[model samples]
Target: MYRGRRRVSPAVALLLASLGVLSGCTNAPPPPVVESTSSTPTSEPPTEPPKPKVVVAGIDELRGGFNPHVLADQSPVTDALSEIMLPSVFVPGEDGERVLNSTLMESAEVLEDTDEFTVRYRIRTGASWSDGPPIAAEDFVYLWEQLRRQPGVINPVGYRLISDVESRQGGKTVRVTFEKPYPGWKSLFDHLLPAHLLKDAPGGWSDTLDYGYPASGGPFAIRAFDLDRGEVVLMRNERYWGPPAESDRIVLRAADRSENLNALRSGNVQLGMFTADASTMEALRGLGEDIQLTTMPRPVTSTLLLRPNSPQLSDVRVRRAVLAALDRQALVEAGTGGGPAANLPAHAQVLAPSQPGYVPTEPSGEFADGPDPERVARLLTEAGYEHSGGKWIRDGAPLNLVIAAQFRETSYEAVANSVADQLNAQDISTTVVTPKGDELYRTMLATDPGVQDPPRSAGIDLAVAARPVSADSAATMAAQWGCPAVDPDTGRTSEFNMAGFCDQLLQPTIEAAVTGEVPFRRASERVEPTLWSGAVALPLYQEAQVLAVSREVSGVRDGAGFAGPFSSVGEWVGAPGESYDW
Candidate 1:
């Protein structure tokens, strides 16, 4: 089992107290209040309440604006921003469970025993947007039409199944009829935009709101956005129907990895998130006990994806030999700094170990603990390869393979170097390539265009990348490894299926899992074995999201998955008597 949070050493705590950073030490009692010296009955003017302290948070760049309907802006930063400024019918809990947001919705249920599947939702009486427009059924209808028409947008799979939406009781009640049964209907309307704002935009609904959001319906509203300065300021929504936010304002700013660490050391930022490697955690420990670290398993897993079209990996034996030559445990330890509490070896591609529905596939005898040179040589020989002059040669040609990873992922680059060294020691010739920016994505989605006499290889035999899984295990699995989503008109493929993995034999099982025809565990069990046997991708380990906070901050909670660290920001409170100039 994975631990949610790890405690620091006792020596670090002592250092924090000595530096006057830890505020939890013992304190003396306060003095009693004394009576006023003067007996005059003169009245004094009332004093205004002190302003709430601003909490500065560091995050990556906010790409694609705040509107998630636009495919480009649907990033982790957008997810965090939406949690603070949008109204949702269902909210995700810290334990990977969904709960109703009573502030926006009163009740949601499915009509029983009907030929047509329909869901009814009742909006809260006082729910209104920041600009004084009521949150009505018309907003949902508009959202459905936009998403239904734009199939290639961010998440249109579920909306495409809905046939119609009807509003009753003057926009208070909504009825949604689906073309088929969808057990995961609660995940549909997590964020809804105000219909009145975008209904009259010029070009199209998908591309109209690409720059910034105009209004908010949640606890916080956008005060200012300066793209050139890379800063966004949010203040409490005075028109909110629920209780006021605990903190008056939040400031999100873009910063590099080094800048984020420096800000935490100087008390400029109260909280930040990063991919915690061992070195980063050690550096934080040196900064004293004032800095606190908490970790939770992320929904992403690192894998080495193989191109089936490549001649070197087209043979199943050659793929098996490649797996047997590398030590997955060492790679995982090096990538995560040997912190068992922070990371775990990945056993399945469809679901993370901490997720709800995960089944461990039986290990193949090869590559379980460490490298097996004997197994590698045996497999290579069976595939008509022989060792010669420290390299495997077949048909008088050297069996050289190229491995590549993105330059931005430093940890992954280190792991790729280590893999190359290990494979070379076992008489396999492997070269490592590091591509930056657009070149990296192009390499991952490489395919033959059939323009030449002989089709060339995808230019990479194996690529190192991370696959992000969702709480809905079935849908995520289908999207990652099932049939490719090809455009009917352009003959272009969806970006989701970049690996180009298409197995018709498993299509029915994937459909059953996606449509909720079978239990999650049963579907997972039936699919994981086939995925493992094919060896198209090899998962190395699971990554954990690391959050650093100051000792003065409280009410910081881990999200259900990768929703964001600020899911519970409304309840956050700073230390008493602390002064923040913002």
Candidate 2:
């Protein structure tokens, strides 16, 4: 320390001493200094700011089900990816009501509620997919055509009510005529895929969006997705029509509970949204005040779906008998245990019990509380089944049922075992088959085996699967029960009916209720009794989605319904600090 001043280098000091001696010797004749002028300043150059880090978000699993609309292709990573990359007609506003996204639409309004309810949608001229195609009616038609009958879709109710979709303005504008007024129409076409890319490619639904969305219309687009490395990266879409996203990039990393927690503590991941146990939740709590943890109800319910298309279970009486034979309370207990799902016992068929305005649409006394053995027996007898040698039989073949459950889901496996045991006790020969999720949802549950002349014996008649139920009450009702209308012109039948059963009689009422023709409550009142009597679904519980975000990232909040934390991805940015390694 040189007298509270920065010490000068020895070389500079020597140079200074030499200059002083030379100036002293030539005191009279000091040469006029010639100035060499340059435009550049003599000061040191300014240092550039450090580049921002890629926002790493930890997710439970990268199951790679990136198609948010399809139930089978639903996971946290998928939901997050879809929310940021997919286009929507109406985004959830501050009040959670459907508001038009100015970027995607020029105008969307009801043309008239005439004989056939008509609505018009005009796409913004500049709106185009990340790939190449312009965002147009073709995309809308593709989704409606695929969702209406292709099966495994989330919200197809409003699409089912559409009698026709006519494209105008060189395919930029769409005129839709619904069979009735659809109040939840805004919920349709939230995640529109590129029609030119996926409409005709084989495995149109499941295989296309397996890794990531082929095209993005929103502010971000998928850059790279690697399941082996457990990461899906999204970069800013340079071609996005609206205001650019504030963040440079978003990376979703697949991780287990412990690893996810570790990443959060180590700051390897700034935000995390994953499924967590009590211990994991506690671990998150221990991460101190900086971590923001939230628990939201996932739009999924564990359900025992009885498909009526099986020749053995074709009769409505037989389907109801199957419901009567099983003890639902035991099934729920076996599946949920003491998990988060245990708390939200699903009571209604359309709207999950956790949803707002959820009244137990479970009819008064069709064994609303428990199994009814007498009801099972009477229904079997009425359906022409004869009880002989402790087994129900028709045409000398025993009443054997094949139940399919996805092997990947532990809770569902337990639920399936419970269902099998309950049915077996009632003298029903039941065989529980554990199929891969793809086979279970895409093929077994999706295909109507009974469509063949002699019903296919190899396929499953019942499925224990996760049914995603959204807060859109009308959409849920129609998606679950709205009969896939037979188009007399095209002659295409419903392919992926979640429940193989179809009720033509109740379909119109369902249509009326789903479309704004009948109020949701009144429609549910008129629909639930007959719907429950059909005994199609045995909903166990609503699954809860968990999110843990650190203070390092900002602008996280719940969206309208199933949008999750990723809804605000456009506004999310990494906190300024040291550069990140990842």
Candidate 3:
């Protein structure tokens, strides 16, 4: 994600003020300073109070107690907060390169052995949690144990490969040994919980840590979390080893896109991050000089995931025909408000266009940017499908497919509608189903056990979803396509495979990538063709990450993917000449 600032037009500034503007002055000029005549002829002018703590909106909800390890509660907001309040040994830079965060770790190195790989991290001196517990190797061990034992933790695939962890140097050094060479080892340990807090819980860490974590080690700590009001307040961590946070308090309020926009226009929030559709950007520009827009290439790809084993989609020809029937460019244009530079049509599913080692692959056949009716008809016919009365038929039944997507994200809903419309127009009977809350989770992972059965049985054939690829493309690709891991004790399969897709042909490439046996570019190139051949996921486009900040809010940095905007919160400064009291 690139970080560049663009100023709003003067006309837009006037419009924003008329809509609902926050006053330029936050503290009413401090009553003109009162001259201080009674203070025995004060020798020096009073120091200006700090500006009001910056308020930011656009957080969807405070879930999983702001813990990254908690799978169910992980959201954009929580991910952002985790980066601010947890220990991150390495952080992804604006260009998707890894940068060391020296406040958390003094140094990190990878040592290769004959049979295993060893990664060591040395804790920074005087690194302690807000509650007085010094950060130690035990925290890393606790994190690994919790993630290994609990399958519900998100992104546990890499941690599962770690055979053991050893602590040395008076508990200041942590050594992680992997069974084999893991290329993505640098991407781990971004969020580490304090082991002392939950080490003695009777229940598993996942169940016992549902509530929000109250202590923190990073630049900020949680001060209050009012779930009823959907608001969270974070104060600067006094014990932080690095430079203190710029703002005295950072307030995050849960609001929808529309609410967040209104909050921005009204000055209730100083910074807001959302999808900068053309209209939204235009609106912000029209609101005038108060707003500043920053644009970055989103690391997420909007995708249409097809069920692997569904009888209807089992045929490669049918899948290819379905892909050929939709116009990907049109879908992207509509989703990004016709801003060509804002989004790009995605051809590869494993790595986004902006990521390193990404090579663009062309779509198979003549389906590149098309609603190719002739090609669709020809493929369908070759696959034993017949068109009668403007509806496709196969095996004496109408060719009906259900498209599933979550209703919570507006972009997915729009993409799903567009895809469904395109298919329906091409003689395919299509139904768009949007589920929310528990139903939405079940719909997304329906193929997994206890998720209301496979959605294919419910006539759902396609799903519009968004998948985030990490800077370490190897680990991400492996997690998505590698064989599922089965627990020896429980005889249950891990839920890491969302599409229930397993191809022996692709597994070797994935394995090579995961184990650093092959170069990332070579492995990615090798796997891309096979993924396209299977037609498991049709990538629509790479969404752009957009954030609107007030003119007074400076030092805001853009983060990679779901890391959000708080990666450099220590440098964030509010309005000038005002001191923040609360």
Candidate 4:
């Protein structure tokens, strides 16, 4: 239901143009050959040759430095290794709707006679690690144990859905069982690591400019890495178990947006990721036959997080007043969408309609117009606050609030400013604080009640964050709202409920969604209303993973329509120029 914004990374453009070098975007005709004349004969026997496959170039800061244990800052690096190293049970389509198959275990049904919540799995019998070791139950058990120990490993996105992961191995069979029914069980398909290789490896795994991430389980492996030069190369695995991957090798290079655009135009690379300004998108659009450009949606949302713990924002009235004043639709229109931009407004709860537990709520009428300073003044007065001249007095104190967001993203900063202006009209002072990434995260981590060792307050009032939803389920929606999750800071049961907000009324519905014996779909229908009424997480547009491919390449399709362009890589192939299959 939510039409997402197009993602166009610079690297995607370069790759599309590179295909022109291999073969024209339009099919190329056979080359004319000079025949040998009066050649003394001889053909003893004829030998058949192998087919030429399409070679693509991907962009990752470090082709090999991706780690499953650490918070991944490198999407490109993860995308490159996803096919080989990452593991998930199901993958989302380009549209951020539906699911796709990966290394599927034969059966995933819960066992009826089992002592606990166990599900039987018949892992693809022949599945093997990149090092030729067979993929078995032990690997899963080991990985889960390792993950539990390193709880700080970010991207716990969908991983927290499970209560436990137990495995049984005998001969070539492997069974994975869960402690509870994780509604979005299909999300675990993106990446799986090799337990044997990392079992004894110190510090789990890491990436550096000089070293690669780890051995892969996908079609390619890191053949070369150079951090100083900011580039890496991938070669096809000759002993791949499944149908040999279409491409034997893919070369990836790192470059800035400008450099990536230049590469696409000159045909130096065959594929690139593109995300730039409107002018940049327009420029690439005019390139025509030289390179092919297509837009895909990425499952990402941009938000303006409000941190309430700061001295200036201790009052609940200030926070509510801020939300009441700003124009959310205007912000969505100004910042998102393609060209003029088509951003999915976060008027309702965070999850898209396509996602489970999604209930559409009216945006225009839900809250009042543009921070009505007069209205805010009334609310403050009701809360025992008085506006004396220009300053607000709450118990003889000034009414002020501090908002935080990273300085890099101008859009969020603009949102902060707009909110500030509206709140200011009511005589409530607002300060917008912009910090760098590490500084901001550390500040928030220490102050946020959810992630801190000992939460300073009821969690930062608000913090803007983004995560890819790997599955469509009610649990996913709840996680985004920060509900029912264990609060690391307080050692209390809390969801990412950063607002330190909860509704006892909604708990039963949420519990039903989580522990219901009925199907996940049924549970979702039953739970959506509770979230809608509570105003959980505010929704935002779903951004796309911008991917550019050369016309010479064929059979490329994304599972979630055009959003996740890499969802369908199994059928991709090289163009049949002379003798190669296109």
Whole-model alpha-carbon lDDT for candidate 2:
0.77
Per-residue lDDT tens digits for candidate 4, residues 177-208, read 55566555554434666667676767554323
Ranking by lDDT: 2, 3, 1, 4
From the highest TM-score down, the ranking of the candidates is 2, 3, 1, 4
Report the lDDT of model 3 for residue 449: 39
Q: Which candidate is the best by TM-score?
A: 2
Predicted model with the maximum lDDT: 2
lDDT of 1 by residue, 1-582 (tens): 123335778999889777664443558555699888898865544555565667788875654445665433444566678788878888776565877788899999999977888999999878988989889898899888776544324345566568888999989899999887877778778688878888987744655555556778887887877777777888788889887788877888778767888988887888876666677667766778887777766556777877565668878788888888888877786677665323567778677777765656746573557899899999999999989898899999988888877665666787788888888889889989887523444334434333222233346777776666655667667766766544433566544343556678887887677678986678777777777777778887777756778876777776665556676787777543333344
Given candidate 3, what's the lDDT at residue 60? Answer: 44
Please say which candidate is ahead in TM-score: 3 or 4. 3
TM-scores across all candidates?
0.74, 0.82, 0.80, 0.73
Q: Which residue pairs collide, candidate 1?
A: 64-73
lDDT of each: 0.72, 0.77, 0.72, 0.52
Q: What residue runs in model 3 are displaced by over 4 Å at the alpha carbon? A: 1-75, 93-96, 112-115, 145-155, 167-171, 194-213, 227-230, 254-268, 339-342, 364-368, 388-390, 436-460, 488-493, 559-564, 576-582
Output the TM-score of candidate 1: 0.74
